[model samples]
Target: MSELSRWEDLFREGNLKELSLGAMKVTREHFGNSVFLRGLLEYSNYCSCNCFYCGIRRDNGRVERYRLDDDMIYAAVDSGFIRGLRTFVLQGGEDPEFGTDRMCRVVREIKRRTGDAAAVTLSCGILSRESYAALKDAGADRYLLRFETADTELHSYLRDGVSLERRLKALEDLRSLGFQTGSGFMVGLPGEDDELILRNIRLARKLELDMIGIGPFIPHPATPLRDAPQVPLEKTLLATALLRLFCPRAHIPATTAAGSLEPDGREKMLSCGANVLMPNISPVEVKPHYLLYPGKICLDEDGLHCIGCLGGRVAAVGRKLSFDRADGLICKRRDRVEAGT
Candidate 1:
C-alpha cells in the first residue's frame, strides 16, 4: 500500500478509512482550513470540435448554443464579486467568433475592474502561441486546459484536432508566460488503462504544474459516446487521494462531476486529496444550456444562490468553503506566520 506502484494499491491493499484519514491529514498540512473560491462562468457554448463526451459539440443538435457578449461577461464578473467570488474562471468552447482580440479585451477589462480582488483563469480551448501571449499580456493569472488524457490516439478519438502534443505545448506555453498552468484527465475514459492514468499523473507532476483538474468521465447523451459507461465514484475518490499522496502541493479539485455522481462525493474527495471546489456561477436558466456532460452538479443554482448551500454542504464534510483559495492554485503558506509565535 505504501509503495503505490499501481493505482489500485491505494484502495485494494488497505482500508479506505485510513486512506481517507491520510488524505485529510495531508490536505490539512498543505492547505490548512482555507478553501479557494473560483467563480466559473461559461461565456460561450459554441465549440468547433465535436468531442464525443461533450454536449456543446458543433454536431449536437439538441443543444441551444449561446455566447455571452462583453457586457454580459463583465456582468458575470461583477455578480461574482457581489457574492464573494475572488477568482474568475472564464471557460467556454473554442468559439472563433469571440476571437483573440475580443477575448483579450474582456480579460483586460475584468482585471481593470476587479484589480487584485480576484485572479482571472482562462479555460477557453486551445490556440496558437500568439493568442496565448495576447491573453497573458491582457493579465490572465492562470490557465486551465484539461489534457483529458496523455494517450494521443485515445484523446484524438474523443476530441478531434486536439493532439496530446499540442495540449502539452499549450501547458508549456502558459508556463513560459509565468502563468500557473493546470492540466487534467477524465478517469474511466473509454479504452483507457491503468498505465495511462498513472502516466497522466506522472506527466502532470513532471510538468510541475500549479494545478490539476482530475474528474470522472461523464457521457453526454447527444455525443458519439453517449452509451459509454460513466467513471466510478469510488475510483474518482481514490484518484483524488492518490493525487494528494503523489503531489501533495498541487492544487486539486473535487470536481463537480464527482458530486453529481453521489451526494458525498465532494466530501470524500476532499477527505482523500482534493483541496479546491469550483461551484458553478453560471446563470440558473442557462445552466442546462452549457451542458458539457449529463447530470452535471451545481446546475440548479447560480453563483449567488449556491454560496449558502455550498457553505452548508462543505460544513457537512467538516470543511469550510470560501473565496480565499477556493481554486487552490495560489500559494501562501500560513504555518510560517504561526511559527513566529
Candidate 2:
C-alpha cells in the first residue's frame, strides 16, 4: 500500500496503540530520549485580529490588555537563561505597537545579552517580508507562524477573513529569509475533520518545517467558539503521533493545551512522539492575562518553579530534559552540507 493509504487505514482503524508505537519508533530513531525545552515568553496579549476562537482577540473587551517593554522582556529572558534554558521563544499577539523596529532591537539585545549563547525564536503573528528579514539580520534564529487549520474556508472564518494563501506566503517568506521556520494547527477546530487533518500533515511536509506544534482545541468562555463542542483529547494525540511519523526530524512540542485537558496529557504526548516541551517562562502575574484558552496549566507558578516541575515530568516519561539550543535535525544537516563538512 502507498504511504498515504497506510496512514488513512491507521486512522480509520481507530487503533491508537499501533499508531503510537510506530510514531514512537520513528521519534526514537531520530531523537532518542532527549526532550528539548524552549522558554516561552508571552510578552503581549494585544492582538489586532479578532480570531473567533481566541481569548485575547481584539473584540473580546473583557481581556485586560498588556504589553511588556524592552526592559521587562529582557528581564524575563535573563531569568530563563539563568535557569539553564538555551532557547527562548518570544511569543505575542499581532500588536502593531511592537512592530519591526522594536522587535529588531529586542532580538539584537537578546543576542548581545546571551552573548549569542542561546537561540531566539519569535512567534509574533504575520509581518511583511522586510520585517522578517530585519529580524533575521538582528540574529533571530527561528520563527513560528501557525496556520491553525488547513481548510482555507475554515481558516478564513476563524481568522476574520484572512486567507490561508496569505499565511502560506508568510511561511514561505520566513523560510526564504533563512529562519528555522515552524508552523502548527489546532486539532479540533469547528469544521475540521479527518481529511483536513491529513491535509495539515501534508502541508507541514510541503513546507519542510523545522518545528510542528499540535494542540487540542480548548474553548475560551469569552470567544465565539465557547459554545462549540469540545473535541476529544484522543484526536489531538492521534494527530501528534501522525505528525511525528510524517516529519520525524521536526521538533514537536507536548503542548500545554494537551495538559489542560488531562493531568497526564503532556506526558502521554511525550511517550508517543513529542520530543519538546515549552515551559511558560512569562511572569506569573501576567500569565493569567495571556490566556489563549481557559484552564491553561502552570499559570500560578514562577519560571524557576516551572523548570523544576517540568524536569520531574520529563523524568517521569523516561526522557531527559535537554538545555541545548536543540535546532531541528533538518536545519543542522543543511548547515553542515552548506559548509562542505
Candidate 3:
C-alpha cells in the first residue's frame, strides 16, 4: 500500500501507538529534539463574528470581554522576552478597534522592542490583502488562520455565515505577502470522519503550510454546541501524528486544548510529532476571560510561571525549549537572504 493508504488504515484501526511512534521519528528526523516556543497573547476577547463553537463569540453576552491596548500588549511581550521567549503570537477575536493601522503599529512596536530579534505571529482572524501587506511591512513574520475543516458545509455550519473559500483566500493572501502562513483544522468536529481527517492532512501538504495546528473539539457551555461531546484524546493525537507524517517540515503545536483534555496531553503530543508549545503571556487577570473553550489550562499562571513549568515538562520528554523564532523552512530562507546567499 502507498504511504497515504497506510496512514489511513492506521487511523481507521485506532492504532495510535504505532502512528505516534512513526510521527515522532518523522519529527526528530526533520527538527531533531528541539521544540520551539511561541508565547500566545490573547490580547482581546471581543469578536465581531459569532461562531457557533466558540466561547467568546459576539453573541455570548455572558463573556466578560476585554481588549489590551498597546501598552498592555507591549508589557506582555516584555515579560515573555525576559522569560527567554523570542516569538509572540498576538491572537484575538476580530475586534474592530484593532484597525489595520493600529495593528501595524502593534507589530512594529513589538519588533522595535525586541530589537528585531523576535518573530511576531498574528492570529487575529481574516483581513483584506491591503491589511495583510501592511502588517507584513510592519514586521509581522507569521500568520495562523485555521481553516477548521476542509468540508465546505461543515465549515459554514460551524463558522456561521463565513465561507471556507473566503478563509482559503485569506491564507493564500498571507502566503503571497511573504508571511510564513499556517493553517489547521479541528479533529472530530461534528459531522467529520476519518476520511475527512485524512483530507485535512492532504490539504496541509497541498497548501505547503509552514505550520499546522491540530486541536481537539472541546465543547463550551456558552456556545450552541455546548451539548456536543469532546473529541477523544486518542483521535486528536492520531490526527497530530498524521499531520506530522504528511507535513514533516511543518511546525505542529501540542495545542492548549489537548492539555485541557488531559494532564499529560501536551507531553504525549510532544512525543508524537508536535514541536511547538504556546505558553499564555496575556495578563493573569485577563486570561480567564480569554476563554475560547472551557477548562483551558494555564489561565492562572503568568508568562514566567507558564514557561518555567513548560520547561520542566518539555525536558521530561527528552526535548529542550527552543529560543529560536523558526517558522519551519521559512527561517532558513530568511537567513539566506540576510547573508546574501
Number of backbone collisions per candidate, in order?
5, 0, 0
The digit string of per-residue lDDT tens for model 3 on 135-224 reads: 999999999999989998889999997999999999999987888988998887878888898888889889988888988889989999
The residue-by-residue lDDT of candidate 2 on 225-264, one tens digit each, is 9998999899888888888888889999999999999999
Query: Largest TM-score belongs to which candidate?
Result: 2
Provide the overall lDDT of each model, using Cα atoms, as 2-decimal numbers.
0.78, 0.90, 0.89
Tens-digit lDDT track for model 1 on 91-131?
A: 99989997889989998999888875688899987888889
Question: Candidates ranked by TM-score, best first?
Answer: 2, 3, 1
| Model 2 spans with C-alpha error above 4 angstroms | 336-341
Against the correct fold, how does model 2 do in TM-score?
0.97
TM-score of 1: 0.91
Candidate 2 clashes between residue pairs 3 or more apart in a chain or in different chains: none
- Model 3 poorest ten-residue lDDT run: 327-336
